[model samples]
Target: MLRPFLMFASLAFFAFSAPVQTPPPSGAPAAAPAPAVPADAAQTPNPVKPTAESQARAKQIYGYDCALCHGEKGDGKGDVAADMKTPMGDFTSSATLKSMTDGELYYVILKGKGQMPPEEGRAKPAEIWNLVIYLRSMSKQ
Candidate 1:
């Protein structure tokens, strides 16, 4: 009789001690916004001129680094673009290029924007300027 009573007490204690799971809140905080680019950084001009040699170098670099996501033709329809969470910029559109200045492009390339990774450490400043020229060519197409 005592053994049965002890077993019953143990079961009752375990049942009461079981953790209670509460439903999560309906609303959760949104993710933090991306950092804003400074006026000077956005206004900084590209010192490199668009020469054939520079453009060729830029093309090579872009093919190796940017073409995977920016597309081989710079149309923003790259192979991996569909799988990316962020929206890719359409470089082939004149309207899009017209709105953004060289400085803004430089800043974006250096610091990265939205889901784009920064090319600061990976690419030199001259190479980045060349890339800016290559991007300009994309708009003309």
Candidate 2:
């Protein structure tokens, strides 16, 4: 009877005690409320419209090497355009770049056009593909 009474008293005491509130796990930080901002700032920037990785690669190569002969924006009005004996075609014209295929452009890049030196030793096949993508992008079609 004494043992049973002692057990009942211990159970009662434990039941009356406050519940143990476990703290958050270690290394975890409490989240803070988000700050309010202007509605305009909430608008995300325009997504990249390149649409394809190849197009992006082409733009990169054009900016690096061809931009001198072809404008940085491919307007065909690059800095070297004036000095070059054979005028570089205006890429922004749309009609010109549209007609040519990736193969044709690659050939020109490899063989060089008029005064434009062949990049045979300088650029690899993959790099030339990028240039083709950039040229195709210039076309309106």
Candidate 3:
């Protein structure tokens, strides 16, 4: 009985003791920065940050294009929100916005998440930037 138990323990130990495989050693410097992704491939796309004039232009465009779903106050409770299956995001939450990069925001706006549809045709580039700025501004409050 002891002999059988010892054999089983040895087999178990061997089974658990397989050498861990290490990843390939980093012999060379890291690769260069990747190129930006194009608008066509990604569901949500981030555009480069806009200039002041463009930002202001973005605001107007946002009011015209985005206010329906995002709300006039950026609170995610726009009038049309009732029509959506997914509720709009609550922009006032710093915790939620801080983790997301500008690019991530762009992607969400360009590519609708869950119930939201992509804004690609609904908004021009400038309009999207305004929404980004609005989201960024939400961080302060």
TM-score of each: 0.72, 0.55, 0.53
lDDT agreement with native, every candidate: 0.81, 0.65, 0.68
Off by over 4 Å in 3: 1-50, 83-85, 121-130
What lDDT tens digits, residue by residue, belong to model 1 across residues 1-141?
999999999999999999996653533333244557788877888898788888999999989888888889888878877665336778888777787788888888887765567899999999998898899898886
- Candidate 1 vs candidate 3, TM-score winner: 1
* lDDT measured at residue 45 in model 1 versus the true structure, 0 to 100: 84
Q: Residue 137 in model 3: shift from native, Å?
A: 1.2
2 or 3, greater by TM-score: 2
For residue 115, model 3's alpha carbon misses the true position, in angstroms, by: 3.1
RMSD values, in order shown: 7.8, 23.1, 13.9
Off by over 4 Å in 2: 1-54
Candidate 2 lDDT at 67 equals: 88
lDDT of 2 by residue, 18-105 (tens): 5986664643343233333334433423233445776777677678778887778777788877564336677777777665555566
Give per-residue CA lDDT, model 3, range 1-141, as digits (tens). Answer: 999999999999999999986653544333334334455444444555667787777767667777788788677889878564337667777776776666667767776655455778988765675678767776575
Clashes of each: 0, 1, 3
